[model samples]
Target: MSEKFKITITTTLTLVEQFQSTLSSSQTNAGQRPNPSTNEQNKDLDPLALLSASATALKSHVTKLSLLTLTSPFTASAVATTLSTLNASVLPSLVTAALLVTPDSHTAAFQSEIRVLTNTALKELFFLVREIQAVAEAKASKKSLDQSEKDTVTLAAGRVWDACDVVIDVATKGVVGFVVRRAEEYRDLVRDAVEEIEEWDPDEDGDEFFDELLDDDNEDRPTSGDSDDDDEDSEEAAAALRARKKDTLRVLKPIAQIYPAIITNRLKLVPVPLVPSDVKVLESLMRNLQQIPEHIDEVAGALYEEDLQKYTSQVGKTKDCASRAINLVVLPWAAKQSSGDQETVGDKFTTWSKTWIKVMGEVSKSIDKT
Candidate 1:
């Protein structure tokens, strides 16, 4: 092998190793560091923009790496350059962005998510570098690239490309957009759960109910009338089951529908230039809203098995989530208003939350009676 090729190989390998070490430390410390106070100088540093640029740069490098010929003399140098950029610039910017957002509980989860995507991309990039090194070494040994070797490089490059694209996409969305997108996803989940529960057929899918319950609790529950029960008792049991299902759907369907509306309004009411406390309230509100669909799913399962007790309990939990979410929004908005304008400024959200809570309360009472 040429001396230049040998030096390139050593340099690339060293850089990759260094990068791996740095990335490991960054991932370990992600979201744990205290946020630095922002000054006028720091105000110009847009972490999201920096993240997007870094991911884009990495993607460009990976694309070039993917196109490298097995016998290419520049393979090692090219890989080394990418690693240098990653270690020196990309990784530091990512760390800075994460630290800046970590102190705000509202954006903390988002910062962590962005870190995960960036880390995955970095991991894949590291793998691609290794694959490139293997190919370069194989070529130096006068070996022709086999189909498997080619496929390995191609697959690794593709994964790196995909992972970087994900990071870029998320960084482009910024924190608020990320939260809105997530809320929309959760909204869709609620809608899907509502439709699934509305169309559930216990008679047609009797085995499914038993299977799900068995998987969940490792115990069998009654699916229908006991063999010892008389016709009259079975009839009464069927009637009660129908009543329970009706009551559940009546309250839950509207509750599910109203959740998305609440999410939208809350997003609107979120203060611009949010303070730390505001961030906490928004985080709590979103967290509570996210739990609604899970509780709804549980209620659906309970209704499927005609488990009145479980169904009632799940319904209560769902209502509690909705109630808490509403309060999270209303209470914060009210606190922000002045004494003179409190009634006028907060009237809209107050009315909205009160209507929601009142409906939930009424439905909860009716469900209890049933």
Candidate 2:
């Protein structure tokens, strides 16, 4: 009896020491930054570097806790507490500020740095959320936890998740809003360039047409039946129109290519795991935006000048495709069981694409005439 009692005492003490170590580590981790760097010089230039490093370290802590808690049910409380503290901390604010700034505002080197850091932060936060949910579920079924303890764990987990939702929302909106604004600015630039090119040589060099193409002596043909001179004047006008069309296409082609390239670059900057509805909307918008560059290339082709009318029909068909994307993909996704109550799908997606298509049609028409 004495020997058996000694073994039981040793096992209980061992388990107690393990739980103490786990709890102590959780408390220590709560205050710790993700990671630290020895190179002070690099940190000086890139302020976000430390914050991102800290996020990585915190993510490692939570990941370990999540795995450990599977066998040690008592550790769930520690993981929940650490995540709750992180959810209420300075790290999320730092990430939000970093993503809100436009990438163009920084130098190329810094832009790449910030992009990597921001992506890392986003991935870390997503991991944190997932781990917190796991803790909540684990706590709910944990045989070691009393009913009251389980309820507390559930409530704390719920609050941490709520905080995560808020952070994700703000980050997604800030990043995507910046991209949309940049695309709109590029669209305006294209519109203005098209208008300037159109206003130029409005009559297609009508004065030069009279001098070079028409008979110089026949400035004013007789009102009487002089069919020969009238036919000659008509021929000069047609030749001048074609000449003007070619010149316009040469200048506008480069300007038109600018819009889609800039928009695509901006869109690519948006972070992942966006709300499903936003993902659908942005994906559709990107597809439509990319079509601009393709259609412009088609119009810029060697054959386009020979049959401008055919390309105009191509532009119309492109417009139909954009419309179909909205109807078949975007609208249905918006109305999906998962879409919730965001009823302004038309304003959010459909209307924007329609406006874009309208601008493209006007541009195509301008080119068609050339």
- Best model number under lDDT: 1
> For candidate 1, lDDT tens digit of each residue in 170-256?
877665676777778878998898888767654353478786877689555444574346556766777776667667777876677
Looking at model 2, residue 316 earns an lDDT score of 52
Clashes of 2: 2
Worst 10 residues of 1 by lDDT: 97-106
TM-score of 2: 0.32
What lDDT, from 0 to 1, does candidate 2 have? 0.45
- State TM-scores per candidate: 0.78, 0.32
Report the poorest 10 consecutive residues by lDDT, candidate 2: 100-109
For every model in order, what is the number of clashing pairs? 0, 2
